[model samples]
Target: MSAALVLDFGGPVLLTPFELVADQPGTPAYELLHQRGPLATAEQPDQVWEDLQAGRITERAYWDARAEQWHESGGEEPDIRAMIAHLYDPPRPELVREHARALVRDAREAGRRIGILTNDLRAFHSEEWIERIEIVGDMDVVVDGSVEGHLKPDPRLYELLAERLGVSYAEMVFLDDQRTNIRGAEALGIASVWFDVTDPDTSYAEVRQLLGLPPDGAQHG
Candidate 1:
């Protein structure tokens, strides 16, 4: 059986929405974050975000709280999707990580089927915005939770991706920034890597090794 590579969309494939907002000051996202005050910021740590990271709170609950906060602050519809659209309505290719693109290309060159298993592609992005992302088009398959109604750590989601890629769990390697999701994949007998957003190159190197591709700057046949 051939090896396959599956990646989570948010942190592994693209700069996260928080990182994007941080980079672009004077934007609505930036303003919203500033107004929210201390939610995942370096200067002022927020307990809610900490709870989310510590697995005390669900991802959906965390975002639902943020949506209510956004609405209270005079923002649009009190939904996580509304917040996502507000922050990323006009998606740009620059938001896609260059290293991720290279990893996908290398995997393709190495004859591995590539897939994206994301919990919120359609939930967080519009059709037009999704179309603008060239890296997504490079994937052999994309199984989205918004469309499939099943999110990871759900075994069914992993099963769906494996089914689409025509590979067994053992024949695939998965990468995700969230530990819970990583654990889920690992439990299913899939080799999984935790992508560190802080040091992406290291994660990329690990992925390359897992896929049996040449290391960065080494020759590839």
Candidate 2:
């Protein structure tokens, strides 16, 4: 049976600024990086991140909350926009993408459905960024957490994706870097691939093999 390929945008398909933090953990550039990701610190829950993704909280509001949290922890006043800007205002480079793009092209050409399910509504929905990424046009569906008001691990989001893809939940092969998100999809009967997202070759190779596609679909992939 032809299956729908459901991919998580950030870590699985392409690396983002948040995942890049570990590389420069001790530098001046990395100090505010600690205030990144869904859970900025170990003690804080991901509630604010969820709110940001779900459109319940504005971007500025989310940062304000982070700032308040920092003060509570006895950290001095933080430059919230500086950190947010560092992530948002970058030349977004690809960690790995060519093979993934080829797979999308080939799969679509062969009549299989493709979709991206991400907590990244902010960028993918934006005209400029979507054009920059170049896969938005190729995808049969794009599920943005903010637009949908439902983030991943929420069964409703998967249901919406299946509806949009015109496929059953199980017919979609879901791939994500986070284990919790993988388990969430699995709970609803979707076969999930736990991607080691930081390592491009391994994760991409596994995805290629799983989809029954040739090794390195792109010329340089």
Residue 9 error, candidate 1, Å: 0.4
CA shift at 53, candidate 1, in angstroms? 3.4
- Give model 1's TM-score versus the native structure: 0.87
What C-alpha lDDT does candidate 1 achieve relative to the native structure? Answer: 0.82
Please report, in order, the local distance difference test score of every candidate based on alpha carbons. Answer: 0.82, 0.67
Off by over 4 Å in 2: 18-29, 32-85, 88-96, 123-127, 218-221
Q: Could you tell me which residue pairs clash in candidate 1?
A: none
Judge candidate 1 at residue 188 and give its lDDT. 93
- In the range 22-134, model 2's lDDT, one tens digit per residue, is 56666544554445654265675466666655656654565667655545554455555444444444435454366567767767766778999986546333556556666
Q: What clash pairs does model 2 have?
A: none
Please provide TM-scores, in order, for all candidate models, with all chains considered together. 0.87, 0.68
List all candidate RMSDs to the true structure.
2.9, 6.1
Which 10 successive residues of model 1 have the least lDDT summed?
32-41
